[model samples]
Target: MAKFKIDINANKHFTGELSPVFSVAEARKASQFHKGLQGYEPTPLRDLSSLAEMMGVKGILVKDESYRFGLNAFKMLGGVYAIARLLCEEFGWGIEQFDFDKLKNEVDEKMTFATTTDGNHGRGVAWAAEQLGQNAIVYMPKGAAEQRVKNIRSHGAECIVTDMNYDDTVRMVAEKAQQNDWKIVQDTAWEGYTDIPTWIMQGYSTMAVEAIEQIAEQGLPKPTHVVLQAGVGAMAAGVLGYLAEELGASDLKAIIVEPDQADCIYRSGSSEKGEMINVGGDMATIAVGLACGEPNPLSWDVLRNCSSHFVSVEDKVPALGMRVLGNPLAGDERIVSGESGAIGTGLLAAVHFSDNKAELMQSLNLNEDSVVLLLSTEGETDPVNYRDVVWQGKYSSI
Candidate 1:
């Protein structure tokens, strides 16, 4: 039998009916309302000319989100924006009154926020709550990393470990919020609670908006292929919305990558419906951000229309990504990365392999003239994985 886990699959799944709900102009307006958000930061898009040349591309760039609000991950953008929007929408205040820094400094400590996470999103929600001088309760699965649990606790949030996985944790958190009237802010969407998650997705549009501006300034052509790793599709929705509004569907070919174990989008494309799968075991890839099942319905709608393709990357790709990018940058230059944050570049490598290059390139249909963009959504948050991938160079060893 073919090594199913090692084999790469080329699957093109698209839904012809879904339409864009938010435009770039609308996203821009939301971004303006978030002008002084505490965790907002201008992430850098660094040129990888040398790496691009090595991969036979004209240009390759990495949108480094390592320094986003000093949180070391892009999850904060969505979480913070979602929470801020929820607060504003709930309180009927203008953006000026919801100014995060000002509100954070003055808000009563009696307030509370709640969210469910595999790790990063909960940490982000907890961090945002702490910064805003509010109480936070973070729910996680039973097997969540000690580091993430500790990180949430460090931010003064109560970390409740449930006897379930990430998806179950989400349900538990929702139930708790319903019973207790806690402010539940999640980046993923469900029925009746799409607004906050949509706002969170809108917050992620800042990355795409920034990418377009940075490409213009760097003298690089527009990206021909933009690959993103997704869990619930919030991040991908943000980028797709930007591309649909600014570049149009024909200008940019987009792909959503996920681990073979948690390929909800891949399966959704194949089946033409949203499906939920149980998540458990051996999710050792550092790119843990995308390890989610049960696609976000709104995001699923957008990705179905806007994204051109979906690919399932192996767990090993993340290890390789960390080894490749983390070695020279982290070991020699002191650059650090979290496992879940580095998978964008890993997707880039998987899509550019020599054996599959012919079909992959044909699917994407680009030559040396093509420009590519990858989002590095976080720096190393787990010190142990950081040291192993960066200093030890243990990607293949895994």
Candidate 2:
């Protein structure tokens, strides 16, 4: 039994007005900015028809971000774009006037870019810094996988494994960056630190743009429900922003999923005015990437207004999702999704297969006619752990 907590956002008051924080035009601009980068390409959108039938949905479309920029994660779209924008500002050049070679040559050696991550985000930051010819310092939470640390270091970043939880590490890195005058390219936002994080969120909108375009090209109908995995709600807000613009807020259901151990978004959505809430302590979940204790305030506004539901699932849920994707039944194609990447599918499975199916399905308004979209945000970023979970069926040990 996968333990889960779900909340229907009673404070979700969408007056049919789009989010003011991000727009479709900004998302398109971000996509254009990404296209100017070296390895810019749209990741594959796979149709998991077999899985959809098994889950009793009309269809399931998954945006496989495992192939994104060889980073095995969608975070590069955000990190790289944020880095470029920061460099453009620092060099006093317009976006089109920006030249990577010139910036690389003129960049100060003492200037170091920094961020805190569970894994993929730090790798994206390190990879972006390497591409831009700048130094990067990445901080990871205490229990971060060794393979992830090595991946970050492979991009020539100074990787530090901090003896803190994910949220504490983020706070530590932010404070140290401020004290040392290093530029912090974080995905999460708080007061007075909203610009870069907003840029990061805007950059993430590129993925949604690509997915929407791909769905159109394939002649498929717009998805009725979008299940997004949330860590501070940046990616979810980005996707929701674009979709809410293209398809009105009432046309689709936007669901946010997070680790039960780090249910900040769930708590916030359940609050009186969707107020920001903090979950303090060591959040131990196999879905390490979503192990954030606090919701990003900038993203909170977008999510509270546009998103319909917030879900928090136990660790076993994602493990089971990984297994399901890895061992596809019959005609279903195999998908290599990591712990964090598979949570959306996991949440779907938990709700659909659990004993409380009727209540859960009715809450999300899911039915056989509903078309569902899931974002598999990463591949097997950690191979050893992936092997254990998928092949060995070792959910508890993880």
lDDT of 1: 0.71
What's the lDDT for residue 377 in model 2?
96
Per-residue accuracy of model 1 over 3-104 as CA lDDT, tens digit each: 113333333444433244557775776666555664456788877777677667887777887777777777777777777777776668764457666666
Model 2 vs. true fold: TM: 0.95
TM-score of each: 0.88, 0.95
lDDT of model 1 at position 46: 79
Question: Residue 21 CA error for candidate 1 (Å)?
Answer: 3.4
**Global Cα RMSD, each model:** 3.5, 2.1
Superposed model 1: Cα runs more than 4 Å off:
1-20, 38-40, 101-109, 272-286, 328-335, 351-354, 393-398
